[model samples]
Target: MRLAIFLLIFCIFEYALTVDQTNFKTCDQSSFCRRCRKVKPDNPKFALVPGTLNIYSDSITADLIHKDNKHLFSLKLEALEQSNTFRLLVDEKTPLKPRYKVQDALKSAPKPGSIKVHEGDTEFTITSGPNKAVVTADPFRVDFYQNDILTVSVNAKGLMTFEHLRPKPQQPADGENAENPAANDVKEADEIDDPGAWEENFKSHHDSKPYGPEAIALDFSFPEAEVLFGIPEHADSFALKSTSGTDPYRLYNVDVFEYIIDSKMALYGSVPVIYGHGGGTIVPKKERIRRAATLMKNDPYTLVVCLNSAGKAEGTIYLDDEKSYNYRKGEYNYINMKFENNVLDVNFIGKPNFKTAAWIERVVIAGLGRIPKSATLIIDGASQELEILPHGEGVAVRKPGISVQQIYNIRLNF
Candidate 1:
């Protein structure tokens, strides 16, 4: 009798719950997103100021000016040490107050790497190792090349926008100089240009935009990319699709009740990194197993795993330390071990909840010396082919979506 009552109550609760889309704000409702999206195509507005380029050993600093507003912003380009990575930062040259910056994203400050600069009449070329970044001055654009091949371009779409900080305009008194030219101009501009600059309302919630408008936006282009992925916390496909006319892939974190699939809306968390790939080729049918095993043996996987299983599963294995920890305090020791038959066996814990599956996507294999180009999965003594797509210096393993509450004997041999 008690069990029957519990089951009846569970069914009633599940049936009563439903996702209400109106609770979340869309791109049109967001004043900043709407303003940024309205930028015309291929019309550049920002340029590097002449005689303001300051070149350093590991970085370059310059002043960028907006064509219409003439707003000045500081630009810094830095190369990180021992890694083929570059950082770009832009902010107002002189703000009324210090702006808020993200914190604790990195373990520590990265040591600076050496950079070679080749100044040109209209552009600046900075090279680190075999990769180079070409910065065009007039339009303020950057193109990145790996091994002399065009890989990624920054601000290439001319959608870059940075709202400068300024004091709020004072309202004119009802009777005192109602036609003052300065006050009239300010009032006219606010009414004609910004609709939600000071405040906005979404349903029952109201937002007093204390900062007025301080949104930053930029576009990154991958010319030869076949698939683009990342910008997580979305119930979407493994490979992201185009969001051209609709709302963009948002990166805000919010509690979305029973989120919809194939949607770019943000969920409970966000990881703002996008990876583009174009050099993935299918391995031959016969040689897939051998090539995969070899690649797996040469590298170590160092990221998250989203396991899919039906019932309780158990397995164990041993691996040599990959030397990926802080060893300066004598807390880490590197070791080398040879697995039985030189094969690494991995066990995964499955998450049967449908909503959680969308939150956890691919398995990233990192911290190894090099990323594997291919991967092989063995389940119940049968070979299952898988692709090892590249994500920066790591590899992402993706498989077909599996339904929840299914059981199978899964073994990974990489």
Candidate 2:
């Protein structure tokens, strides 16, 4: 009986590997995506109306209209003062009902900066320092430029779509009149045909779509980027690949079980952030060393600083001392670090009324090239030039007074 049960379980596991994935919707299956992809660059339906621009102290607002439907949309462009990042938002000017907007995700409201809007015959440009956003009137497109280099663009390939809310058509009962004359007349007046506008279904699940189709999609193009990363929380590679033949990178959060790898299928968590880098200019081979700084705070705090010799400089610092009883009682200590020109300086500051035996047990500084024959370590007011021991492609520097409760300055020079 035991042998039979074991073989049955193994067979079931093997069969589960080839389970059907028809429950997931493809781009063509989605009504909004299908309609958006059909819009050509040369013949777009949406256009920015002239003389509707409103320039404020920190943002630029305008109204865009659909040529065919005559629907109006509000467009706002703001430049973040703190980070110099630009944000472009588009929504219905006056939606019939309030549409769902994502909230509680941002750490806090962004600080806005002054932006000057330059109006021209063909386009309106918003300039803030070295970053500029050019809003083209016809065909409705926005391009972001950093230091005169085009970094990102929206609707560059003309895949923008905004499904407006409308009244759901009432279905006639069996044996009753198929359609009313007035309703048919209105349907013929509007050329757009939305088959699954009122409701959508996949497998055994049905989406009632109470507020109608309100899906918004826009294509973002990065012209001067070679590699893109982030948007993780997936069991995939760090470097994101192209989604040419497969589905686009999905951000919808789902509880996936035994999710597939190397696909755009969203897993446990979803964050709508992506980082792009590695473009333009090459540095000298000898001066290509990369450096990184990280801070880890917990019951026990730790800081990691390293330089990349062979690969990119990266490390994870775990803090296990932040949960101590003294910390909860309002006692705090800090470690300040500064790195300049092949030298690392660290200063430990302790609280006046709090005295706890806390110390950094291990400090690993990797990518030191070769173990130096001798190095200098200055602790407190004393200096000692000691022979350094070789670590894995680096050197290990240890201090005896790191655990004591006193202010000290430790400087390491290679």
Highest-scoring model, lDDT: 1
Task: Give the per-residue lDDT digits (tens) of candidate 2, residues 362-390.
Answer: 34455455554555656667776644556
On the 0 to 100 scale, the lDDT of residue 70 in model 1 is 83
Error of 1 at 81 (Å): 1.2
lDDT of 2: 0.63
lDDT of 1 by residue, 257-375 (tens): 77777788778878889877543111111112445553443232232321112111112222222343433344332222111221323332332222112111234433344555565
Runs in model 2 with CA error above 4 Å?
1-11, 14-23, 171-183, 187-194, 280-414
- Estimate the lDDT of model 1: 0.64
RMSD of 1: 12.6
Top TM-score prediction, candidate number = 1
